[model samples]
Target: MNPNVTVINPTITEDKESKIRVAAYCRVSTNSEDQQNSLITQMRYYENFLSDSETERLVSVYADEGITGTQMDKREEFQRMLKDCRRGKIDRIIVKSISRFARNTKDCLSVLRELKELGISVMFEKENIDTANITDEIMVTVMGGLAQEESASISNNVRWGIRSKMKNGTVKFHSAPLGYDLYEGNLIINKREAEIVKSIYKMFLSGMGYDSICRELNESKVIKNDKGTKWLSASVRYILTNEKYIGDSLWQKNYNTSMPYRKVRNKGELEKYYINNTHEAIITREEFEKVQELIEQRKHPNMNLINNYPLSKKIYCGKCGSLFKRRFKNEKSYWICREHYYNAENCRTKPILEQVFYTAFMTMYNKLKANYSVIFTPMLTQLQELKNKKYGSNKQYIEINKEIAQLKEQTHVLARLKTKGFLDVSKYIEQVTEINAKIEKLNRELRKIVRCDDEDEMIEQIKEIASIIENGTDLMTEFDDVMFESLIEKIIVKNQTEFEFNLIGGLKFTENSIDNCT
Candidate 1:
């Protein structure tokens, strides 16, 4: 070895001979038998290949069926795989094609860039592209662009085919709404289901609410939906409002708009076709119109009763963690747990009479007002120190350190240039002095950039809280909405007898029943 060169042991930088963790992702755009078979085949091939490989360790195989690749949110398996990759549970991912991974070019490129930063790679078998190779990125981008365009084209073509049939009055949507059955592309009323539909409409017109109708149907054990679940208020309203029961068909009431398509209700976004007498009537048109009018009337029954209560959503149940809704009983206003009011079994806590809760709250507020400084002074000091430490360890300090390293490297380069006769000695000295002066200035700025006092922020928060509440030590005789809103965050009811009041600034104090309060 040359005397000028320093020698070190080779073990420190040697690559470890660990097996690579590999996973495969597969997806099919349709749920057709043929496409499903193809997806299963692809999954089996990957499983066998990874299992048989000597260098690769099989991690997982994530598959999504009948989900379009354009939208990542809809694909559960794809999202789970990405999450696993983020958590370092996956080292490499293999997909059959770029389209299988993601058809949206922006999403595909963004995911690849993030994976690159994580030292993870994705292998697209059909394109023979590896994301780890820097040179392959441009090619991958081009391929991803084509795949996105292809998906859009396929979506447009499918829409076009449907629109053509719709224009000819032969379009068929495979939905099978409540009282209708598809027979040779025409909706025919199923008498069994139609009777149930008729009964729902009659019940609605006879002054029964949606909830009451739901309870009646559930009590009778009428299997409502295709899933055989008990009727819900929304489903009851759906059956009541359906135009199909009135012997008409409305087509294209909803449509998917643009690439990475989202299905949205068509409120004149697109043309809708209405066909008259498309099916046998379950209910008369007059009855349907009457129900619609009744629905409109019920929507704003208490429009004049405006809520001015500031603590309407602020107060919460201590037992079930539900909000306390204002209720009026026998000319008295009280706050009760909404869950308990709806179902007592869910929240067994007794209602905290509004006057009783108000007194306890005021007593606690008076105590906080008297001891504010004793509680807040030490807290402010601790927070100030933490803020200073955070500023010191911030991003600016890291960037400044990197810049200083680069400046030092440039000075060394200047020295080499002077020795090689490429730079004049005087010129080299001048450049070195200027660079050192810049470095010194940067170092001074870096030091001051850290250690900043957040006293202004701390003081502003305290001032806001102080401004919202009265500054005196006198106990509040009645409920002060301003004081409650400013100081109280939430009240957790432990039971009927006790509850904990959590304050805005992470302070908590417990209070007992009305009998225990002074």
Candidate 2:
């Protein structure tokens, strides 16, 4: 018989105890009792389901209770599961539905792709689709899009209800504002807080600045915010500027905008409603308007009534590092160190003519423009390298995790040995302490590596700087204060004739003034 042809069936061996580890993910968007019960039910159902399957073992049940599906960062258990998945501790993930996994289409797809790369399978029960099943990918995408649209529809409906209430002046206030108490859908004056509000307005009109008013409130120790914190200048300012004190309701002064909703100051984004005499007045309308005028006057002190100049608060005295304040001398704008102008002992930096300063700034800015590519090229190249470079392999991550696990197991063994009188107590303590320290060091290194590996933020920063440069071709020809502000962080005046220009991208250049002091 030919030796190659004589074949017997080879006995294949496999780890019989090894089972596919399955983790169930559940989420509820609210802390309501009903939602909590539903969450508990999900946990129990998943536990029983996993327990009944002989081929599968329950590794973990990750549940994000009272967390919105829109925000993944807020889901602690969900993040932990992903971290575990990355560590190869999980083989499969099961979720109640795709909407429960993520409502955002992009978030859902991105997470699925990441999981796919890790060779992990996700089963969405409602969709009855397994991500490991390649044919269901299209269905998953379509369902994800539908879920996102559903989420957007819900958001829009909620917004419509809020806007309707706002337009009718029937909007609900979650918490009573300072000086007002919410009773039966109406704002009634809180006697104690109203007195404080009135005092804040009176003090402002009486020539006491916000700082002084805040100081007075603190010293009296009678006025405290809703949080029981001492009065701040900003808090005093809020009371001074609030039109609600004058019995007018300015609804929609701020509104939440965009997905992942951030509250933004309503600057003509939506229609604002101003309902007069909507509540009890803490201050008279005339007084409120007069205070507003006073505030405006303080804000815009120039003869032309400009609120702020290009370098209003950007100039810093090189010697004293104090902000240079704008002043007028013989109808000519000049900038002097505020500390030096107020108290000569604090700062003695001489004043510089605004015209002279601008000329010097332009000259330095022109020089920076001339060498823009040369100056930023090396820096940008390094950033590009960093952005393009592949981060450390997952092998290292796996190895580190394995080492951590081994260290943890050794610690447990040390405890057992000490308890059983098999090892010296001193040796156990010493070994455990040493292992813990080593583990901590490894953890720190791991965190550092992870932080460095994430180049998204760095890439964004680079893109932002690149865009500024790309759009700033005409930067040297004209004096655009906004552009100047965006690029230049601060202008340091070394002297009346010498200056340093500090750009936001960390490039600093010096220029000598050609104009002489008159």
Candidate 3:
């Protein structure tokens, strides 16, 4: 034996072999039948070709149809293919070309990098390029860059065509909001829907109330946003509030979130475009202005009316994740946080009146409803904690730890009463009912501090129900709490002073519910 070479015992170890699985991704963006046929042919060809090849094995074939390759998301087959690659089931991925893989440069490079890290290869048949090949990386980068440029070109071309149409007054938008429809590629009046729209406008201007309008719509079986569905006060108000029903169309209100498949709300970072006379007019400018006037009136402190618009439902208490209820004092309106309403532990937040803390809201509602312009501050305090007067400020968040002793005492009393078992079923029920009624009454009293208008119609409806059962009824009279529930959508009880609420959109006038206080 040579001095440098030494003999050693040979040892054999089992290799943990993974399955040589393969999956192919096929995509066709266009909805044309011919393109669809081409996709089917590609899928079948890959399936048969891989299965027939001696060195290759067919594991699965995922096909995404009628989805743009330029977009990374909204592609089921592509996602599945990537999933298999990550799960080690797919050792190789075969696609038609670089464009089929991804037209966006960053997306293609990121996906390629991931697969490369897993020792996987993507084969592009048209370019005759494989990730396993030495030259594939450089070629793919160039090809992917070209594909991305092409996608941008196509997008610009489409945008240009649409803009041209808009300039020529030929482009049309069919989202009628609620009161209008497309008539011969232009917006036109639908008589019945128009009447309802007009009614909402009148009610808003007169400050009748969103809850009343919602009840009226539901009673009249007004169609929902679409054909058949229940009406929501928010939806009803959205129709009344949307400006596109007039002649002006606001485009570019939002921007593309990502290169492929996501959209985010416009954060005012991008510029927006507005096109007038883009389509036929549904309502005249005078009518539109009149409707706006009504909206402004409802928001006015003097009107003291509730708005039934969809986006009006959100009133959050930054202190606790509770809703605030709307309140009215005299002719002025304010939103009261709900934590204070129920006397819950987290109720130390400050209160804001209509004339206080005006620098907060920047939404469309604030712009439309400019009722209180005084901008004074409030001095509401609970348990000796100060809170900001801003609508959604989270500055004074605190952990509440009060009322533990009271809760413990109540629990002990309940336990002792239950153990006694001396009372009959009806007597027990009566006792429990009395306690519950007391608690409910107390809670309502506390909630009254955070005023939420349930509209005159819903409030009266509940009163009518209570009136019909005036024969000195038992606890059954209080069993139906639907009136309270029907009137309030969500009461965000934020701290002790702030709260918010929304009224019900669909209401049946014949609906029966009981509340002791009308």
Candidate 4:
């Protein structure tokens, strides 16, 4: 029986041989014909390579076209591949090189470490480095650094070339602005869009703000850019400020940075080229200069507040909480809610006449003067009584202050305990958080008491307002800008026929505009 015994070699079963799930990632920075062909070739190569291997199963070939490799976030296909790997869809990743994976060294190692932790591996074909086989990432780090350096070098060269072209006035306009077309390396006026541009400038110069201009353009169904997008304030502002409309070109207004690649405004970080007569003029330079001056004037608070547009920042819409902008129609100034002016559907508040505001102020001031004692004296008494009630006994205030002091002492004790290792960090944090929350609630009660103490300030402001109203002319027959600016804080438009005058000390008085003012 011993002589007849035979050893049977174990046969490998099909179910025991598990194939590695593989995914390929490829990226081309540009969509040039050559790059497109390279991407297609890479896809075919990955397909054939995986198909020929019995131990590998092809999962997907992720390709990102016309995307920069320096920033991993910008590569959609690369991120998608990582997401799939995280979901355990693939066991192995294949990339052409470290540069294709990431030009950022940190991003490369971070992703590699994550994959290694998942028991997954990455093979860089050109570098002949497999993450699974390598004991450490020193070589990968060095290669990634070199790749980053190469990217920075290429970026510098490209930037230099662009600046050189800009200096020589040989740079081509790849895409023309809203008013022009790029033709033969020059900006040629596109008549249709140019008209829109002209209208925008005209409206802006004619006292229409950006929102109003955008609204008018959108209402007219005017196409903005080639995308036919709806007009926005930002787009209108760009059209207004762009020097291209004045037959000039300003190059390198924005430039790119290398390490963490991003485009930033030049802002004197680099030289900018300003060439004249680069295109036909959409608006005269004088008009453009005037528009610039107006923009500056409107932007300056002193100019808008004290010099021009007295009511610019003083009017509000009670219905929609929007500022009321001044618009002149038929030689009469009207104040309409900015939201209502832009889109009537958003806000239905009707425009109020500027004269109505003036008359409303006069009437409110007169009424205040007539019944100053009846109106403000009781208010002052009420405010004083309320203040006294809050701090009269001083018991609640004292208790809150005492508790806050005790909490502060407790915090100091906790800090000392933490410093001496008498209390663990987690317990200390919990105790300190509870103490601070109690201290915060007590502080809030203290703040309420302090606010009540502001009664004297309010009483003084009301007295000053009364004195200003009474010491002046007996009858306010004419609208006085000086008095209105001095006394009125804000005029809230309640509706088409009513206005609420919020006086300097927060006294609100409503006036009927339909009967007299309007």
- lDDT scores of the candidates, listed in order: 0.73, 0.73, 0.55, 0.77
Q: Candidate order by TM-score, highest to lowest?
A: 2, 4, 3, 1
Q: What is candidate 1's lDDT per residue for 28-75, written digit by digit as tens?
A: 887766987677677677877877677788787777887677789888
Q: TM-score for every candidate vs. truth?
A: 0.45, 0.53, 0.46, 0.52
lDDT by residue (1-518, candidate 4, tens digit) is 46787899868866424888999888777766698668767876787788778788888788878767777878767887888888989899998988888887899899999999998999999989999899978999998998888778877876788899999988878678887888876888889888898889899888876656766997998976432345655567677889999988899877777687655566686999999887789999999999898877765433553325646667889889999888778777788899999999999998888877777777877888788679877877888788667676798787887788788767756754554457887998899999999988887677656644456456556665665665555578877654665566677887887888877566788987663322
> lDDT (0-100) at residue 115 of candidate 4?
92
Worst 10 residues of 1 by lDDT: 299-308
Model 3, 373-420: lDDT tens digits are 221111112211221222124222211112333433343344234433
Ten residues in sequence with the least summed lDDT for candidate 4: 299-308
Mind giving the per-residue lDDT tens digits that candidate 2 earns over 59-120? 87777776566788888778879999999999999998888898877789899999999999
Residue 237, model 2: Cα distance from true site in angstroms: 3.9
What TM-score does candidate 2 get on C-alpha atoms?
A: 0.53
> Stretches of candidate 2 above 4 Å error?
1-21, 30-61, 65-67, 83-90, 117-119, 135-142, 174-203, 208-236, 243-249, 259-263, 273-288, 302-492, 495-518
Off by over 4 Å in 4: 1-18, 40-51, 57-59, 174-176, 180-192, 211-233, 276-281, 284-290, 293-518
